[model samples]
Target: MTALRRLVATALLITAMAMGGTAVAWAHAVRVSADPAPDATLATAPTRITATFNERLQGDFAAMTVVGPDGNLWSDGTPQVQGATVSVGVRPLGPAGSYTVNYRVTSADGHVVSGSWAFTMTVAGSGSPGPSATASTPSADRALPVWPFIVGAVAVIALGVIWSRLRRT
Candidate 1:
């Protein structure tokens, strides 16, 4: 009975350690807030679009774009990263329709996080649209989670330990 209890305790500890490691490894930056907000309707066009993440962002390859209703890029200049926030200037929006803000940023853990949100412009603007979206748009491919593989390895180890102990009995 004591041996069985010890085996169980060891297995639990190992499982906990594996889960903890994976939790840290999987800590990707998540968008906590955005300027203009998602699905927001505004009377005036914003000068810039900003995205705030839950974790600090990396400086490299941080790209943001505001695509206007006409399928042209409204985002002007390069994207700036300040801590957990990433933003880009808008080149005066055109047309009174939906504008999508697409962002592809690198998280603190060197993981790539990308997403897009749209806001409606109730009023039209005088500023001309930027270049076409086809000319320049960063790819926002999401990385796959590795927690499942970690969990599987933990289960296998626990099962092997239990089986070995039982065979010894």
Candidate 2:
């Protein structure tokens, strides 16, 4: 209930809120759309696979690969980054099963975003499969979770409240 203690508690609460807001603001480019589309079933295979993100992406460190059901890489040459779209040439598709598209791209914020999605091919193509995907390409399972930071901020605010109450008694 003291003036100094109240000021300190207010400062902590404000700091925690500011940090949480910042964490939410810190974001990477997210895929807003795709060529074949996620989980889409296609009767005909497309020559190129493209993913459009929500924001602009960095031209450097952008890579994408399309893997056929045969477990071989079908992507040809290098992946291209144009504004928010990232695409790569597919060497025709093989097998009628599901095909996976993996991508690792740098966001305008300079953080790397990576993920994968699959689409089913109803009919197989005549083109041969490319070589297996190499480990050299950067791929990430997911982006870093922000829950921990939020939890920590909540804990700090809770502790501040508890300390203020303890000081009153």
Stretches > 4 Å off in candidate 1: 1-17, 140-169
* Model 2, C-alpha of 71: deviation from truth (Å): 0.5
Q: Report the lDDT tens digits of candidate 2 across residue range 1-169.
A: 6999999999999999998878635887889999988999999988899999999999987889988787888888899999999999989788899999988998888888888899999998888887876643445534568899999999999999999999999
Q: Which pairs of residues have clashing backbones in candidate 2?
A: none
Name the lDDT value of residue 102 in candidate 2. 89
| Alpha carbon lDDT at 82, candidate 1 | 99
Cα lDDT listed for each candidate: 0.91, 0.87
**Deviation from native of the Cα of residue 158 in model 2, angstroms:** 28
Task: Supply the global lDDT for candidate 1.
Answer: 0.91
Tens digit per residue, CA lDDT, model 1, 61-88:
8889998889999999999999999999
Model 2 vs. true fold: TM: 0.69
lDDT of 1 at 75: 95
**TM-score leader:** 1
lDDT of the structure predicted as candidate 2: 0.87
How many steric overlaps does candidate 1 have? 0
